[model samples]
Target: MENDGSAIALEAHELTKIYRMGAVEVHALRGVDVEFSEGELIVLLGPSGSGKSTLLNILGGLDTPTGGTVTFRGQLLRMDSERALNLYRRDHVGFVFQFYNLIPSLTARENVSLVTEIARNPMSPDEALSIVGLGDRIDHFPAQLSGGEQQRVAIARAIAKRPDLLLCDEPTGALDSKTGVLVLEAILKINRELGTTTALITHNAVIAEIANRVLYFADGRIVETRQNAVQRAPGELAW
Candidate 1:
């Protein structure tokens, strides 16, 4: 892809990751190179075990590539030190996973407050919930809300920190198609409103329609990349 001179939010050069268990080696990534532009929404589509999650983890500073370089806004990310990576993740990245991972005992507002409290600069929990269209449910507990509602709470929690990057790994994997669209809509809103650079991983090919860029992964590599001239709204997406 040709860069039109937009600032790079994140860039990976020849990224590779290998895991070893008792002399057995697993190559999670194989020389993957990619770049994410500032405020761009990207979707990664692939089958399970194709390394989409691994790539997302690396980009979000949750995991280090065994070989390769990852840079954020022109600064090289050093993964040799856990403290550095932890700081990077805490200050720069927000992650949403397949599961909501909400504290069962905490209300929706309280769950998001947990992140805001530790963040350098954060929005009020109520404001964050409202951004995700969950202001009315802020006082509700996880058990009281539906699966889609719970995921919106998770999204609110992530954006509460006001991180520069939002990484979502199958954010809608656990929801029904109708419900998943709601979750995607929340993510889309965050990216559009807050200008957070976003990367999402999903098995559903249809979700790619909403992304500015779509990367198709297979065998730990990005086999194809498609750029959308006009991105679709989350509500316009079917399944």
Candidate 2:
């Protein structure tokens, strides 16, 4: 792996995460080492119980590794103070999940505004919505939108904070292939226009073509890493 600190956005070294379930020990991660650069889109591919989400969670500061180091832009995160982690998560990391966790009663604008209200420097909800091609549907409720539109709203909410990184775990899992492609396009646009570093975790191997780098996991270990010479757009993806 290239070790030039200047270009790296996130780095993890020998990361290991273990969970104790009474008398049983669950090793969720085993000596994983990886680095992601700014403005790069990376896909994490794995099977169930493969620790793909575990790695993404750790990278986003949502969870701490049992034994390892995670650094963001040269700032050591594994041992950071709780307050520091909180600030890091709030200010720099954007997360999108398989489910659109939007407030059911809130309009799309309001949902995006919720995060901007607490951010140190945030884009206006309208601006964020426009970026996701939701400008005209800003006042629509979650129930009024299609699955793809709802996911775009969720994406707008996540990026409203102008975060340096976006962590998505199965972002398109809830949508059909056509709708999922739209959601993926929004993600791709965010990375292109906003220059946000992105990590997407998905079971679909086909999604890897849309990423600049791809990581494959199995049995709680990183089994392979491949860099794409050319990334394809969502519509160009094979699957």
Q: How far out, in Å, is residue 93 in model 1? A: 0.3
- Pairs of colliding residues, candidate 2: none
Model 1, range 105-158, lDDT digits (tens) per residue?
A: 999999999999999999999999999999899999999999999999999999
Q: Across residues 1-239, which tens digit of lDDT does each residue of candidate 2 receive?
A: 75335489999999999999999999999999999999989999989899999999998889889989999999898455788789889989999999999999999999999999999999999999999899999999999999899999999999999999999999999898888898999999999999999999999999989998899999889898888888988997655
How many pairs of residues collide in model 1? 0
lDDT of 1: 0.94
The models' CA-based lDDT, in order, is: 0.94, 0.92
Candidate 1: segments with Cα more than 4 A from true spot: none
TM-score of each: 0.98, 0.96
Which candidate number would show the highest lDDT if scored against the true structure? 1
Candidate 1 lDDT trough over 10 residues, lowest sum: 1-10
Model 2, residue 181: distance off in Å is 0.8
- What's the TM for model 1? 0.98
Q: Residue 120's C-alpha lDDT in candidate 2?
A: 92
